[model samples]
Target: MAPVFAHGQLRLYLLSLLNEGPRHGYEIMRDLEQRFNGLYTPSAGTVYPRLAKLEEEGLVSRSDDGRKATYTITAAGRDEVARRQLDLGDLQSDLDRSASQLAEEVRSRVKGEAADLRAELKAAAREARRVARPAGEPMSGRAGSEFERQINELRSSARKLVRSRRTSEAVRAEALRIVREAQQRIDDLS
Candidate 1:
């Protein structure tokens, strides 16, 4: 995956953020997410380490209050920000580009998933019709009820997984592959 920030850009951006005012770690993360228009959100693992590095370099100072540590920019940090005023614009432009790319990737992935889902559903519907009982037969029985229940459960699970934030691209891709394979197997059974 392409990174949102170039090599040392995240450190510089963190300094710039601190220059704005003292902020807790979570606040900084939220700021970054908002800056990227919800396309990118840095995890705590990413943010805390950078904060530690900045603190180590004397660019920022941290004060612990209860369970939370707030970071404030030092004078040196402000000087660094002043010196990199030109680079700041470049960073913002890079962030904008990254967000656009991320959005496009997301759109493409969703489109592919929709196409796969539609294809699978159509195939299943066609198969179901082919195997369906005669028109005179009432569609109410243990088998019909069980089939309906299973289909509804499958729909609910798919919706929940797709909507979850924890679902990675690999997971989604694997899921689609599994569905396709299942469809193939069902077709074979016919």
Candidate 2:
């Protein structure tokens, strides 16, 4: 997928951020991530080098404050940002659209999954009711008990994963593996 910021766009955007006020490298990174709604975060390697280049060009000045380097945009940086104010506005609009689109996609998928699960549960309940049963006897037995338990567990795990704001790649891969395994198990039963 294409990156959110185009070439040279990041440089200009960083200049615009620094134009806000002095900020340390990590602070700048977090600010950028926040602006993208956690969908995009530039790594330290990507950001520090750009800051260094800006410093070299005298577009920004850096001061060491006890193990932390804070960068302040120079007059030239402010001028550049001012010159491209419209471009900065456009960048903000693009980022807002990207974030909104991502959020909407996630919501739609979650709703679809919930609907599917509800349908499956209803079908299972109907099938259980159709099976022969003694009067006044509640649904209980080894028959389909294991399957129900597994489905419940899977549902709980999925809910937990979805509720989390962030998850590592390993966790996400594990979730996918679990889902695939559950589907395979269901297919095997059929």
lDDT by residue for model 1 (25-111), tens: 999999999988777899999999999999999999999989999999999999999999999999989988998988888777766
Question: lDDT of candidate 2 vs native?
Answer: 0.74
Please list the residue runs of candidate 1 whose C-alpha ends up more than 4 Å from where it truly belongs after superposition.
Answer: 134-190
Off by over 4 Å in 2: 112-141, 144-190
Q: How accurate is candidate 1 locally (lDDT)?
A: 0.81
Question: Which number leads on lDDT?
Answer: 1
lDDT at 72 for candidate 1? 98
TM-score of every candidate: 0.75, 0.62
Candidate 2 lDDT over 67-155, as tens digits, reads 99999999998998999989998987877777787666655665565555555545544444444355566657764475466557657
Which 10 consecutive positions of candidate 2 have the poorest summed lDDT?
Answer: 123-132
Please report how far candidate 1 places residue 57 from its true position, in Å: 1.2
